[model samples]
Target: MSSFCLSKLDHPDLAWLAADRAVAADDDPTRTAAATIAVAQALRALGHHHLALTAALAAADPADDDTVRGTLHLQAGLAAAEHGDRRNAHDLLDHAAALADRHTGDTDPHHTGFGAAAVQTARSLAAHRLGDTAEAILRHEHVIRSDGWRRLPPEHRAAHLVDATRAYLDTGRPSRAGRALLDADRTAPAEVRSRPVGRTLLTEIIRGGPAAADVARLATVVGLTR
Candidate 1:
């Protein structure tokens, strides 16, 4: 369920499916929390901040395993970031980093592929959302330049690059944003092709930059020619 959701994160129907799964799994707190995180993310994208925050908070559980806790905190941190609550976002992201530190053990069914790198990648995202474009790009650079970067899952890396593209655009570097989006597509075609934000970013680049011709090719690949 999560794999599908992650793959087609732009699909509103898939998010609704995950939310329904959460409802069906009322007897399982872990599943409920995990599902809620995905739902919250989708809701946030659709401009339902209030509902998204509520769903994100529902994922929290201090007593859960580190993976689950980290995932929940990550979602909550992202939601807070989107809400412009810089302080809350930073604290929650910090807590998620701590949990990720303790994740040198077994994997759980609820694992969202979050780890130290994921936490750091999340810093770039939160920073970008909070109008700290410089810090956002700087934080993402740490992840990209890490020795263990190659070991990180393609999906996670692609997500980071997508967020990095946003940071580039925010910092008035549309060409760089175009390059990052192209890099993201190379990293995970499904993630880029199916994500609304990815396509939206490409559209903005095409409409707002001198690199429109260069970005237009990739934009066509990402189905943005429509």
Candidate 2:
């Protein structure tokens, strides 16, 4: 969990160290698989997309718990997308979706948060990473419209909103990007203020000219001036 938080906080090196310690401490296959998810996240943060994908795929055990295995596939899919393997990325995500169908509820057992909504959210991010901004926005819209979206953790929603902000920006929609950033801030202030990615996105939105009033205020709150 520390590793996961560290990764979210944009401290990939520290996250990697923590994930390594977790792997060393866990002997159970399922536990180790969970730890490997953190490892893959850290590696992805470090720009080692291929290694991250390989680690996630290797750690996935079908016999393990559904959440853990599905989460592993999700990580692998994201990594694959980042590594430019579009087919493999969607394939892995499809596999995760199938696993999610077997596992109902919005439970976060083992902190995996593996379920249908999570998978759909992952698809949005995967599409974004693959340079399909239109597809990313479409998936994001669908995810948020679903009942499962509201049930996700605040941090998760905020993080996805930040990514969605970027997608909007990429598609020449700064106003929409501003709105998404505001939504992210409302969902989780720390996700906007503490995460480097969020902060950077905020900076981009502000510098792009004529930011929303709320966005400008948020910049001030985060100690980022125009």
Candidate 3:
């Protein structure tokens, strides 16, 4: 269900289904935390920032395992950023970073990227949301070039690159955005094609006027043929 929702982000109904299942299996903190984070991300994609934050907060468990704590805090921070609460977002993200550093750094558990790189990516996204475009770009660039990036799961790696695409878009660099999106798509078409942000970024690139051949090719690959 999560895969379907993630791959077909144009369809929010699927996300709703995944969110419900995640909430239903609430007996396990690890499962609950991961699901809640996924729900929060889906809610964010659906433009329900408040609901997303609420969902992410539900993932919190001060006594849970390191992965759960770090994942929940990261999700909460991301949703907080989307909710326009920069201070809370930074605090939560910083906490998440500390937890991740003490745990596994940047590793994927339950297919959710939770750790140092995830914290940094969330921080970059928060920075972008809060209008610190240059910082977002720089942070994202470093992540993209690091060994950590190479170690990330394909979809996870793609998601971070797509975030970088937003930084470029903010700075009026359609060509750069185009390249970044294409790079992500090359890594994981399911991640890029199924993501709301991916679709929107591609739309923006298309609207920004003549994209390069590689970008155009990626648009077709991702089914953004319009």
Candidate 4:
């Protein structure tokens, strides 16, 4: 999953190359499907949203594993949302939710991280990407209220918080965004200090003026000074 990790690190071009190598090395249907997840992620990172959606959808068909299939649907849903296909995005998310219902607690078979909570978080992210800030914030609040929230991996929770930060910022809630970023840092310091998305959001919050003390400290920690 080097490709997937690379994409998460914002190295889309390297991720794409790694994904290609993964696909070339694996011919197994399930393994190929797993690699396709990385492919879709890299494609999305590169702004090839439509192609990412198509690749995820195609990969889902051959994915016999529930976790892999569900994860593909989530990827497809996010790509569709980024591509501005609202209906398709919602449809794919709903389909992923249905698949998630079959599984019990948060399972990470194939490292897909597909489960009820993951689907819920994906909904929040899709909503945010679709310009539905109200829905995004609502879903995000619902996610944190659920028992599955704490059950998620620190990285997953932290990344979702970063996305939630964007939703809060969109609604002109800089303090809420600041709180989210703080939560993200508390959850996984690297998520805020290392990831480009988190760093950019933190910069935005700082530039908006009058940040909280903790936020200002975090800015300094991340080498971002006002």
Candidate 5:
């Protein structure tokens, strides 16, 4: 699926596409921010690392604000890390973390972004990437507890759960990952819940059982034309 479809406003990589579309379509600031972030996220997911980085940079300096610049750096750094470019990732992440630190007096969760909660989640993701296990865990826990998350749309919540599951798996907590994935599947639409990762995780949980139907359904949901 296209990255635009996957990146929801409620999620951190907030509006790469919406922002861009807004500018292109009607010059709406709201759409511009959303489209820019959405497109940036989509590019990152599709492995267009440099494109993601560029998009983020452009979005950050729309009005040349330091805060927005820092946020974009944070996102670009994360995307770079995911693409296996640790050097650039570290540089960019450190830049953002530094800005966040300076502004909030130690990378405080209440910095600035789409929402306090979303900003905090982004910081947590950065910490997770930087191997700051304790901070990452604390921040993620806080996110789970916050009203912001509870008030999000179902698809947005599912996306967050997917990130949480990945974080759990990364931290060597497979059981937690499994449970989180199941929860995400429950909240997601059938089309989203039927992806390979979701299906495979479910199949593994119910090994040697009647989950073949589920697996098949997953294949169909993801439109695996094979």
Candidate 6:
């Protein structure tokens, strides 16, 4: 049997990609910052909380007060959300959003929506878990329209699409969820495609028993190995 797993969910390649890009673009501080965020997000996704925290801290700029502080808070908020600390997560996320708003008029590109979509998405998940369906739906809808997803690297964009797909599913809108899953599947590479397909299949499973041929087809498309 193959030792590789489709559900393993590690992001070593993303970390490597980010690090390589950061090194190659050392002259561009904004690219470096963005790469740092990517590294942090990848680490966070892979359950390396300490590494993610360290990366976030390292990404902070001592000179640029507002933007740097906001970025750090946003990173911290993401970590907090991952750890299930909703209250602190929301507080830090809101703080980051406010800070971002304050720096929006600045010409610097780094002052943009730094992790706000992730924060809102986390909040939406929390709200859903807490049975606050309306708030969850509203937050997810807002995040779906946000520039954060559009601004992300293509891989991260696919990942966010998966997240957004789940958000739609949690709102009991299976059709919209399926569409989001399809989008993610279309954009994702062979190695990453299965996650979205698995999610889509779960809906099918819930409704009734999905055909083995259908499941096998999706597995083939997704390359069921990690």
Q: Specify the poorest-scoring 10-residue window by lDDT in model 6.
A: 1-10
Kindly report which residue pairs in candidate 4 clash with one another.
none
73, model 3: CA deviation in Å?
A: 0.8
For candidate 1, the per-residue lDDT at 36 reads 69
Residue-wise C-alpha lDDT for candidate 6, range 101-180, written one tens digit per residue: 67644344553344555456656655654456678778767876887656544554566556655666666666665565
Q: Write the per-residue lDDT of candidate 2 for residues 1-226, one digit (tens) a residue.
A: 8887899888999999999899889788888988999999999999999999888888896337888999899999999999889999999999999999988765656876678888999999999999998999999999999988887788889989998999999999999999999999999988888888888999999999988889999999899994
Candidates in order have lDDT scores of 0.76, 0.90, 0.76, 0.90, 0.59, 0.57
Go through the candidates in order and give the clash count of each: 0, 0, 1, 0, 23, 1
- Clashing residue pairs, backbone N/CA/C < 3 A, model 1: none
Q: Which digits, one per residue and each the tens of the lDDT, describe model 5 over residues 58-157?
A: 6666533445556677668778766667688778766776665555422323123533455566667666666765677678788878866664456656
Residue 149, candidate 2: Cα error in Å is 0.4
**TM-score ranking of the models:** 2, 4, 3, 1, 5, 6
Cα deviation at 216, candidate 6, in Å, is: 13
Alpha carbon lDDT at 30, candidate 2 = 82
What tens digits encode model 1's per-residue C-alpha lDDT throughout 1-226? 5634643555665666667676576866776676666776777666676666667666666336677668778877887888898988999899999887888764766657778887888888888888888999998888898754666779778878988998888888998898888888899976677877788888888889456565788877666674
Q: CA lDDT of 120 in candidate 3?
A: 77
Which ranges of candidate 3 are over 4 A from the true structure?
A: 1-8, 105-109, 194-199, 220-226
Q: List the candidate 6 regions with Cα displacement exceeding 4 Å.
A: 1-9, 13-34, 61-69, 106-134, 145-158, 170-173, 183-226
